[model samples]
Target: MTGSLRGILCVLLSAASPAALRRAFMRRQDEQRKGGPTMWRLRTLASMILLGILGILLATVLIGGILDVRLSRATLDHQYEERARIAASTVADIPEIRTAVLDGDRNRIIQPLAQRLIAGTGASYIVVTDRDGLRFSHPNPQQIGRRLEEPVSVLDGRSHVGIDHGSLGQSANGKAPIVDGRGRVVGQVSVGILENQVAHQLDEEIEAIALYSAIALAAGAAVAMLLTRAVKRVTFGLELREIASLLQEREAMLHGIREGVIGMDAKGRVNLVNDEARRLLGITANAIGQQLDELVPAGRLRRVLAGRDAGADLSVLTDDALLVANHRPVVVGGRPIGSIVTLRDRTELEALIRRMHAVTGLSNALRAQEHEFTNRLHVLVGLLDLGETDEARQYLADLASDQLISAEDLRSRIGPPVVAALVLAKLAVAAESDVDLSVTADSHLDAPAADAQTLMTIIGNLIDNALDAVSAQSGPRRVTLQLRDDDHHVRMVVSDNGPGISAEAVEEIFTDGYSTKSPRGEMRRGMGLALVRRLVYRRNGTIDVSPGPGARFEIRLPLSSLDPVASARTEVSEESR
Candidate 1:
């Protein structure tokens, strides 16, 4: 009956739906309070109540299984004790049991009594033994009187149950107590119950409990699955919306970033390239899943993929155009998986750098000229003090006459007043230093088409350098300036008769802040040649300084490239000056 009640409780707990259980519990509470449920409260309260019920049901099942096993053990023990007491009472009543056992007599009556005790009680084996360690009767007896090897506790009037090998050498329970006719200590009567009997009963109870637990567990699992599914269904849309918004924000940020960003996968295939990356690469096709080299055939992209740390601003030329690229490895899990390559157009930057260099070169050359001119002035003063007044005066007058003629000649040919005046002033300075400075031009001086400041800077530096070079010489200082117009270009040449520049220094003479003049000399620190080179490059002109018998600087520029109005006005003003 108790088993049936337990089974029913297990079924009820297992079969109860989470919602039904929750509603049943809430209904009881509501009835006690005389209150009704609200829609919102019902939804939240239902889940909590269901979980609480499930927890209680699970704990109850576990505890019941343990209690059931313990109760079954206790009932088995009680049955065993009652049977043992009855056997003891029956054995005590045997008239010859005590006499035969105590007197060590093995009689037929005691044998039948032992057999009857075994058969009636359904014990595996029965033994009757005396206090003299003699087995008077046994279930299996080769001889009626055999000495028992068991300890005296069973024969000493104490009841005990335990496993032992019987007289026939088979496993059995030796449970029995010895009593005399007056209930004093005497021989023992033992009955062995088979071990399988208790094991079988316990097994049946355990199996029932396990079956009940399995059903309960299955029902709980089903309820949990249903609850999870319902909750997912209710919140799935909101989660998806949040995920979509997050993705959009990520894309927006990537697009808005200024640096060219290219994401590559583990296989070195381009996974994503932002808009700025496309613009930098000058490619419109989607780059996803494509090898980086395919989109931009430059070898730099391949180098990046090979796990090389291509430093920032690395220059590479693609199709004869230079690009500055920065390559960086994309690391994941402490391993280089791919790379990111960013590039910028460097054409204009290179051009500007060249212009700056040109300006610097010109500035240095001008400074060298100034230094030499100072030396020339010192030489003239020395010449006068050495009592060579006539020689100095003749040299001075000849220089003045040459300057006047060159100025008139240049003013008449080159029409620009500013350019012509500058030329005349340079010539006069040359003459005063006993340097021959002449301008031989077939066409008028043209206004600079590009930056006027750059043109003046270029022309001033070349003429001044020539004058300084010649001034340092002991012989007649000679300088020639030639400006002529070709079909497509304008050419200017300035040559001096002083010591020529060394071949090695010619190349680097135009470098900014480089000067061959000694710092101890009267020349200013490096600036003139650098400025000259910069101006020439700015005006789209090329100037080359070479070592001949003396220093010679040649400049060439495209005439058509010049601003027409400026060129025309320059010519007109030179002629007027």
Candidate 2:
């Protein structure tokens, strides 16, 4: 009886313990949910308030300082000009001053006039000198009756105003000739003023400006404080923690996604960058509060931020690695607020795509050859079935002769089998279409720098295009193929006598999905020129199309631009052979 009762008590205790532990776990989770947002909201609100204050203060101070300096300079210049004009006009009105020196009386007339001029103007000094060579009167009485060599301007009867350091230290002076009514120059009246006086005036104006600027700054700062307080009064009462948590959760959702996320404020400052964004940019740390350009270096990111929806791949090289960035603007309520940028590592994908294109091009060429072979076989069979042995033999002979002539011509001019085969294939097609095709190739192209497969594709596409262009002409259907190889590069030019391509179409012919042919046409379908352009770019080559009397497509590829590893492997295989 005792053992059974003890067993029942133990069972009851185990059942209660499980239920209590579950309740405790749920309570802990609830607490975490509540606390996380509260902390984040506080931080976000604080950051926003601080940043907004800093931006407003900086703009206000900068603009105010600039205005103050301009105002001060203008006021000082106005006062200085007024004072100089007044001094010049007062000296001009004294007839006694002019006559004493004009008559060349050395001692009797000049001294009293100089003293009177200085007293009336309250200037630093006045000096009167005769035109010949004598100082008749001077502020310093001892200097009177002395032989004077005046400045050249005074001797030339021209007035001069300048800052000078004479025997009397630094001074500014205005010198004018006392002229007679006949405009004949007499002696000179020299009025000197201290440089300190002008400087003092400027300083006074600057001081007034400074005082007013200080008052305005104080008022502006007070207003700013009041506004800040008002904003705080409204915002501080909010549940900052809850709002911050929601923002953090939203940001987390963005970061967790495969796409890169970036946000900027109105001041062009980066406010948010997710982990995926950092990784995409090859950045290891946070990029907040930094200029987007400083972090991205490529202006692509900045352009997206400036309300531009540039949906194109951007190649960016950071300190750590290269990135292919896709940038777009982030608009709120139909206005651009910031931007979103997505980055992808396209290096491997691009390399793979290039290889695939090369393989696919080779496959297509082989398929075309196979199709032609089947048609030739059918023609040969029909010739034999007609029971005309002699005619069949003659037809066979002529066919063999045409092939030999074409192949021999191509071999003599273009040495490589791949290029020769491409040219021969296009020649066959052009002959069937009744287009006159001419082939001119350099001897060096016998062993071209490009791989056999690449040479076939490049040459094949060009000749095919030329044949197609000439096929539509009603006149002499002529197509010319010229291949030249220099020490550094290979150049191919394919020209046709067909109605030339339009000037406007030439620029966009290489663009993807841009076709000149009708939608129902089967011959000119698919991404032909677009593929050509991609292949050319992958091989570090360039292609240009021009419309002259006829259509001309020029292709240039540097021998050294070939992939080094691929070239090395080919060289090794050739050496082994």
Candidate 3:
């Protein structure tokens, strides 16, 4: 039965006009669209206002009802008191009542006459009493001759009106004195009106107050609805879900990227700084909503944010990290919104680029050597084709001898093929760069100092740097390399006749991103020397630079096991001298 009843109710509702139902559906959709903060605040405000109005109306009604009840009771009490007094006065003036009370006769006078008076006046009770506070008559037969519940007020020579309890419960009662011809009071007559009729009028007043309060509540609700509609109009119609989705998308995009991103509003506050940005700049989480200049002081970043400075490839150095930043203004609707700063780490990329440069240098050097060897072969071919067989033979013999000497020289100097190859490669690179690479005669190493790769990196970077140093010099650009190895140590010295390093800069040259080679308006160097220092130190080596007319760098590496270079050293000293 319950299911069938529910089905019938659903069908009845669904059978309503389609247009009306469609309008209701559209209204619900519209409410959902405009249901974000503006509508929420509207609902809250309207509810509060409506509640306040209803509360005030109810309070007023309650107070009025209480006051009306009290006033009506007072009025009814006054009327009943007047009625009781009039009845008591009239009864006391009656000859029979006066005679009944004075005679104290229950059967013939006081009781029977009091009953007649109560019946005629519609009073709750009527009583006749003597001046000595003894009752002559009462409605209850058992108390017909008993003394009155309270002392007689008429005995004090005054009429009395009051509310008191008696046999018929509580009532408004009035007492009057009965006097004889000589004006001496003999007895008293009392009349009472029930309290219920007085209070019944107060109930009517309360009911009227309740009805008015309900009407006021309904009116207040209508006003609240009007105000709510006004608030809905002010909201510009945005769905709560749409706003949330937009906020969530913004948060996800800002946090998902690896690059550091910072956003500033038009008020110069950091409004959208992300985790990566905080990590890069050493900024704390509380930097949000703080002044941008306070978080990242007035510097390159500040200038970039302002219109005074702008660049896509600008580099900024923070507390510990070097950031390559791209900054641009965020414009919207032909108006400037704010600005966004995108930062990428440049120190790692610089290291990678420097390593690639070394590899390319090695390849270029090999190509140069290959070309030189081909030219030599062409010369031998030309000699043989000219029918100068003997000259060709001598040339070939001299070439073989030179090759043998070069091989022996390499063997005598550094026996390790990787070190030899690196040196040969650097030689071509230096030549191509228009710098003369001179290997001093005193340089000799019978074995490898450390790993070939380590030595290659150390020697390659130093030679490249030395070559760079001399490239700026005007005349006879020259770099000298010296190597010496013994049982305990392998030493390398690379010097150049260039402008040389400053005393102050030499100490800082090996620090990451601290470059002495600053090009015109560029900031991408100094990683090579830092790499060289790191590799040398890893093998427990020492590197030093001598302050001179040209820069000279010396490094000494501890060898695990090395052959003696004393004999070769003596021969090299003699030959050079």
Backbone clashes for every candidate come to 38, 5, 0
The candidate maximizing lDDT is 3
> In model 2, where is the ten-residue run with the lowest total lDDT?
7-16
What does the lDDT read for residue 406 in candidate 2?
70
Stretches of candidate 1 exceeding 4 Å from the true structure:
1-257, 298-312, 318-322, 344-352, 384-390, 393-577
Ranking of all candidate structures by their lDDT, best first: 3, 2, 1
Deviation (Å) of 167 in candidate 1: 61
The CA lDDT at 52 in model 1 is: 65
Model 3 regions lying over 4 Å from their true place: 1-246, 261-341, 345-371, 444-449, 485-490, 514-523, 534-541, 557-577
Model 2 pairs in collision? 37-241, 38-241, 41-240, 41-244, 415-446
Error of 3 at 472 (Å): 3.5
Q: Who wins the TM-score comparison?
A: 3
TM-score-superior candidate, 1 or 3? 3
As for candidate 3, its clashing pairs are none
Residue-wise C-alpha lDDT for candidate 3, range 1-577, written one tens digit per residue: 3233222222222222334334444655776587877647455433555567667766776787678667877887888998899999988899877766566765556777778778899888888878876777777888866787677788766788988787687889898999977788988888998878666765776677668767876777677667545533332232344334444555666678888877665555666667888887878659766777787777555665444555466655444455677776654324454566778866555545555766777778778778888998899899889988899899889988977776567666887887886787677788777788978888887664455555566677788788888888788999999988888888999999988888988877776455666653233655557656655665578999987689999999888522224223322211111
